[model samples]
Target: MVRARVLRGVDLDVPAGRLTAVVGRPEAGKTTLLNCVGGLERPDRGTVHIGADRITGLGDSALTRLRRDRIGFVFATCSLFPTLSVEQNIRIGAELAGRRTEKQWFTTVVELLGLSLLLRTRPSALTAEQRQRVACARAFLNRPDLVLADEPAGELDRMEAAALLGFLRMWVRKLGQSVLLATRDPFVAAHADRVFVLAQGRITGEVERPTVESVMAAM
Candidate 1:
């Protein structure tokens, strides 16, 4: 018989309107943590909450609707539709959430991400960083209560990654949106307001006002 546990008694809290980071190596169950919090995975034990909603025990349809209504996700890969124009890609996010697009907010997000000129372009026509920004725009356009980004800049070069993280930090602060970002990079964690270091299947430590050196030590 074999028993495998991907996460063990994981406990974490992401405060409202703040950027929180989960710092760990690639296989440290960071993604599992995010999935559980996002209600994409059920925890064997323990509660998961987003705002006031207890998500761990939610049924599938309810979880789906909750995620669509209250959370936005940005994946490590640029998960944009190759066939859709950048403008269309963003609009789809609102449409999927049963929202009417708010023009001012949409324009502001596009401009902040430096995508104002690329709205007519397809994902195939954009650079890797640009594609990621489009994905960010889509995630944030609906103004969900929480945003979960799983190694969002993992594929970018150092400069590109920094640029993307900087944009994320700035906009999250500006909009007062809560965020939980999972990454292995100490540099990335440094941008977060708080960092939790995860090892094996559990959270080992945390740092507030994180510096790269502090995160490295915790990890």
Candidate 2:
């Protein structure tokens, strides 16, 4: 059996109230890094921390609780429940955590994501952009300490991707949310406050206040 080291000596931080990004090509361990940080996968060495909590050695139950309470996730796939309305899908996270969705927060999230009119609509009835907006709304509804977005705009058209990234930036600036986004696209990485370039499971460079040209150069 051959054991593959997916991530090697990768050390980075997602600062509070800021959007950080990891830029990497496929098979460069971007998803693996996110999984480890999100506590879905345990690393062979080192530690993971979110705020004051050390998640590295936490039991499954503890990790689950921590993730539920502090972490939000947005992925390439919208992952909305086809059976549920947009509003229902957005509120499901809080429901699962045994927490009631705050009405004001819900309203704000829906409005910001332009999902207000689509609240009663099912996922299957919406456009791809709309569904992804619902996904974003759901992820933000909890106001988690950190959001992990893996290739979140991969499925969107250029304009749609720009819009989504703009909203993410707005959340960081307005709501003071922290985001860690992973992507292979320089355009995506350019939206981040700080961008880490990953190659062959290692962080090869970092660009602060990245632009597309800068990120491309780093890559």
Model 1 pairs whose backbones collide: none
Error of 2 at 21 (Å): 0.7
Candidate 1 residue-wise lDDT, 1-219, digit = tens:
885798997788899999999999988999999998888888888898777778878899999887887888999885898888999998886677677877888889899999999999989998889989998988898788999999998889999999999998997778898899999999999999999999999999999999999999998
Compose the digit string of candidate 2's lDDT tens values, residues 1-219. Answer: 998999999988889999999999999999999999998899999888898888999999998887787888888984888888888899887888888887887898999899889999989999888877888888888889898998999999889999999999999999999999999999989999999999999999999999999999999
- Assess every candidate by TM-score: 0.95, 0.97
Following a full C-alpha superposition, what root-mean-square deviation does model 2 have from the true structure?
A: 1.0
Candidate 2, superposed: residue stretches over 4 Å from native: none
- Using TM-score as the measure, the top candidate is 2
* Structural RMSD, model 1: 1.5
lDDT of 2: 0.91
All candidates: CA RMSD in angstroms?
1.5, 1.0
